[model samples]
Target: VWVRGALRFSKTPNGGEKLLAAASSHKCLIQLEDVAAESEREEVVARYFLKQGVQVIVYLGDITKQEADALVNAANEDLRHSGGVALALSKAAGPEVQRESSDLVRRDGKVATGDAVMTSGGKLKCKKLLHAVGPEKDKAGGRERELQVVQGDIIHEKTDVIVNSTGFKSEPAGVSKAILTAAGPPVQAELFNGQKHKFIYIHSGLLGCKEIVHVQTDQEAQATNKTCKKVLKLCESKGFTSAAFPAINTGTNFKKVEVDPNSVEYQDIAKGFHKTAKYKIHKIERVQNYHLWSGYFVMRRKMEMKNSAAELGEKYLYHGTSAESCHCIERDRFDRNYTGAHGASYGAGVYFAINASYSANSRYAKPDPAGLKRMYVARVLTGHHTLGDSSMKSPPQRGDDPSDKYDSLVDNLQSPSMYVIFHDDQAYPEYLITFI
Candidate 1:
C-alpha cells in the first residue's frame, strides 16, 4: 500500500493492502520487510515520523511479548480514535478499538481525572485496559488532568504506554502526539499543576535532565562554558524551545577569593538563544547559608571572564581599578558608588554578591569590606531609594531638609535591589541574602 508517497510491501506473498489489512486486525507479529527497488520508501517513512515529531520506538527484540500488568492508553475522553498513536492503534485493531473505547466512555460519560477503563487485548498482546485523562484545557478553558495520568503511567515501568488521539491545538496531530511521546509516560501522566502527585523519577541518561551547575570563578567559568555548550546541544537535539540553567560550577568548583564589587559573573547563554527559542538562566541559591557566601564571592571574581555564549549587548563592561590591598584602596565604599560620586560611572550597572556562613550569629555579621561594595550598591538600588547610604527600616522624615545634593537625589521609594550578602568571612555560607 502507498501512503504519504511511501510504498509498502509485505514479507509474505501478499499485496501491500494485505499487510495493512493484517495490521488493522492487530494480528500478532505481522513482520514485514521493505521490498522497494531502493530504500527510498524506508527513508520516506522515517521522514514522515520526523515531520510528525513522533519518536519511533525500535526494540532489538519483541516488545509486546514481554509480560506486563496494565497498559496505559493516551486516549481522549471522547474515545474516538482521532489522531496520533490513537489513530494508528485504531487502524491496527480494526473497528474493535473504537467499540471498546466507546463502550467505556458510555459508562463514564466523560472520564474524570485519574480515571481509567479496561479492555481485552483484542489483536494486541496486552490484557487489562486503562484510559487515563492527560492534561487538557477544554473548550471552556477549564484545566483537565490528561498529562498527570499519562505521565504517571509512563514512569511506572510496571505499565506499558499506549498513547493515542491526543494533541494541542497549535500543533499538527502527529507533531503534538510526537512531543507528548518524547516527554515519555512520566511527564505525560504526572500532574504537575495545582494538585499534588507522587514524585516519580525516571533516569533517561540525560544527566537525569534535572541538575544544577554552580560556577564561581575564572576556572569555574571554563567548566561552565563547556557545560553550557553540552546543554545547548542537548536542547537542540530535543527541539525544545528553552532550557533553564542553574549557575553551574560556580559554587564548589572554583578557588576562593575575597568577594568584591568586581566579582559577579553575569554572562548570557547567547549560543543557546540563537535558535528560535529563548533560553533562561535560573540562579539557584540558598539565602543565609555560609557555604553559599564563598561560592557567591568566587562567582563574582569570575564574572569578568569572556563568555563564549554571551549575547550581544548582554556583556557588562567594568572599568574600576582593583583595590586588593589597603594601600591601593582608592575611592572605595558603598555610598561612593551609589552616588556616582567616586567610581568610574561611564555605564557600569550595579550587581550584588553575597558570601557568608549560614550560622545564625554569622548571618547578621558585618560583610567583608571588599564585598561590602556589592551589598552597598544592591541596597541603594533595591531597598532605600536614597542618593547614597541611608536607613530604609525608617524613611527620611518628609520634612527633613535635603542635607546635600546626594540626599536630594532620592527618587521613588520601594525600588527593589539585587544584593548578595554572604555570612562567612573565611568560607562560603549555606545561604546568601537577597534583601531588596
Candidate 2:
C-alpha cells in the first residue's frame, strides 16, 4: 500500500501496514526490520534525551513490539502521517488518526519545538503514543520550561494569565503599552474607568492568551514587588490553576505612561485618586525583609572588609545595603520621608559604594584608601532626588535661590554609586541628610 510520499517499500512481503494492523488489533508485538535510512537521526534524538539524564535506551526493533507506557514519533514539519514511522503508527492506529493529526495541526500550527500531539494507539499494545518535535526547533521552548525571565515580546506568552503593570491613574507605556495596545480597545476603556491597583481586572480575546491581568502599582522596584504579591494573592483567590507574570514595572521594553494628568480616571472606577494624588505602596513589610536579607548576607560581607566599617556599625547600628540600589549606613534611620526646607527629597534607599575611599564618588571606587577588600559587589539604590551636598547642608531652594541652579548641577553623580552627605570633623560623609 502507498504511504507518506510513496517511495515504495518492497522489502517486507507482508508490508509494515499489515503487520501494524495485526499488532494494534491483537495488542501484540510485530517483528519488523530496522529503519536504516532514519536510524542515525533517531540515535541523535535519543542521545539528546540521554544527556539530560533521561536514561534513554533506543530499541532498533519495531516500536509496535515494545510494551512501554507510550511511544513517540519524530514527525515532519507538517506532522502528517506520510511514510516513515508516522505511516506505520497511523496504519496501526487505523486510518482515523490521519484526520485527527491533520485537523489538530490545522487548529494549532505545526507542533513547533518543545510541543507534542497525542493520539490513541489504535489497536497498539499501549493506549496512547505522543508525537513531538525536538528542541532544535526552539520556538515555544519558553512556555515548555517552567517559570523563567525572558527579554522579548511579552504578548507572545501562552500562559493562563499575564500580568501588566499600571497605576491607579493609568497603565504606563512600557510593557503596559504593548499589552493594552495588543489587548485592543476594551482594555483601554476599562483602564479609563477605574483605579484597580489593589483589585484585578480580567479581559478576553485581546491576545491569544486565556486571560490578561492588569496590576496597578508604582513603577518603582518595591512597588513592582508589591504588585507581584497582589497578583499571587489574586490567583489564589480566583482559583487559577496556573499564572504567568510578563515583566511588570521593568518591562523588556521601556516605560511610558499615558494619563490625562487632570482627567482623574480612577475617580469613576474607584475612590483612590484626585487631581494631584500621588501613588504610594503601603505594604513594605516584604520589602523590608528583602532589604534586611541582602543586608545581612550580601552587603554584610562588604562591610566586614572595611577598616573604619566598625565605626559605622557603632553609630548607625544598621549597616546593610539591599542590592536594589540601596545603601544603608544605619538601619531604621533611612527616613524616606526626609524632605528638608528647600523641597529636597530622599528615598528609603541610597546608592553608595563600599570602597571606603575619600574620593568624591565612583561606581568602582579607587584602590581602597585602607587595606579594605576593594571590590565592586552591586549597584546601590540611587535616584531619591536628593539635592547634592548643598541641599543636604542648606535650606530648601526658594525663588532667585542659586541653590536651585546648584540643585540642577547638584550631585550629578559622577559614578553609578555617587551621593553626598554632610561631613563632621570626626566622621565620614553623611549623605541623604535632608535635615541640617
For TM-score, the strongest prediction is 2
lDDT of 2 by residue, 22-80 (tens): 66999976543445654433322343355567765655566765566788887765776
Candidate 2 stretches greater than 4 Å from native: 1-145, 219-223, 236-239, 248-436
Clashes of 2: 13
Strongest candidate by lDDT: 2
Give all TM-scores, in the order shown: 0.19, 0.26
lDDT of each: 0.33, 0.44
RMSD (CA, angstroms), candidate 1: 24.2
- 208-282 in candidate 1: lDDT tens per residue? 133211112224567657655664555446543334332222222212232322111111111112122222312
TM-score of 1: 0.19
lDDT of 2 at 138: 36
Clashes of each: 74, 13
TM-score of 2: 0.26
In the order shown, the candidates' Cα RMSDs to the true structure are 24.2, 22.7
Give the CA lDDT, 0 to 100, for residue 126 in model 2: 76
